[model samples]
Target: MVSSLQKSMINLTQVLRLREHQKSFKELEKLGAIDVYYLEAIYQLKEPTIGTISKLLGQSTPNTNYHIKKLVNLKLIEKRIDDVDRRVTHLTVTSRYSELINSDEDFWTRTQERLESEIAATDLAIFQRVLRQTIEIISEESREDTISD
Candidate 1:
């Protein structure tokens, strides 16, 4: 029999992945995995260069460039050369991406209300903390795996 802990972990991933696929990532379904990472990092950095984006996402220059080209072709991101530095190219997402990343557009509002109503008030904070810690642990593991490779 599967342990309750294992089932909970599976459920967590299922719910999160379902939400991402159904909403936030629907328009982005055509993008590659690395492309998604670069897009998010670029969005956060406002406008960053190829090297900066590669470093931020812990990916190689050539690999990042490949995804950048794909995103550019899709018209989801824009690339422009710096006037002062002819070799420096900076990237920024188009307006569509800006709209996609808006938190208000997410199902989180309704999900939160449903969760609060279904779950006991006393356990909410504890659940939030545990969820955050779980994410951190997974992130740390990913970093460690990347470093090892």
Candidate 2:
């Protein structure tokens, strides 16, 4: 038995979440069909080995290599051979990605400003906590599923 106000709040939250997700999907699409996992892997390790990136991305070595090659060709990232181990290569973001990073920062800053203007700090804090908890719960569920399967 939810009050009308409470139901409206729920709907508003749902709409906000959906809009954010759609915006993120669009940003990724604009980034040239790059895999989110690969982007995340690169973000986590600014300059990482192909093996490390593959493991972080949960992709095969060859698949990761292929995608990285494409990224290299696009001039979005560069590959450098390890000094100690010439056979091993590491991936690093290229100068071409400076614009991309700036765009991402602008997007986040604008979104944060809007949220700050519209939402109370306490409300935003609570929402952030809930989002973190939800992610943790989902991760645990996924781990359990993987173990069982």
Candidate 3:
């Protein structure tokens, strides 16, 4: 059952990625796998500094900086110097990056519309509750791991 659940999650992720790639083929082409990965990390982390990102990724500062520089050059991300700590720089995704990546929101919206049309309302509510629980479980585990680290 767990394996099946994992497979479904993986399939969902692949489908989303495919949809995003199709929607932003040209912009996606300009980005390498590492570029996208780093962009996602930065986006999720909100305003992580270079050192924080390096630690989270278990990568060297220089290696992380290389990709960060590439992202900045591509205008996909912005680096802001910390106001309180001048030496620390925080990373943020740019509007261009949001525009390119948020195509997946359309995919989700469409999927929800279709699901609402096909599924019974009660069943959909139950599925939604289960999905929320799963996400919360994963988030709690991630927080635990981060705290431990």
**Top candidate, metric lDDT:** 3
Q: Rank the candidates by TM-score, best first.
A: 3, 1, 2
The lDDT-based order of candidates, best leading, equals: 3, 1, 2
* Residue-level lDDT tens digits of model 3 in 42-118: 88778888877776667788999998999999888999999999999999999998987665677679889999999
Residue 84, model 3: Cα distance from true site in angstroms: 2.4
Task: Output the worst ten-in-a-row residue range by lDDT, candidate 2.
Answer: 25-34
Candidate 1 stretches with Cα past 4 Å from truth are 1-3, 24-26, 32-34, 37-61, 72-98, 103-106
Which candidate gets the maximum TM-score versus the true structure?
3
lDDT of 1 by residue, 1-149 (tens): 99998899999878876766667557787976677778876775667888877766777888888899999998889999998999999999998878777644546778899889999987988999998998788666754554565
- The residue-level lDDT of candidate 2 at 137 comes to 78
Backbone clash numbers for all candidates listed: 0, 0, 0
Q: Alpha-carbon error at 71 in model 1, in Å? A: 2.7
Worst 10 residues of 1 by lDDT: 140-149
Model 2 lDDT on a 0 to 1 scale = 0.69
Kindly report which residue stretches of model 2 are placed more than 4 angstroms away from their true locations once superposed: 1-34, 114-149
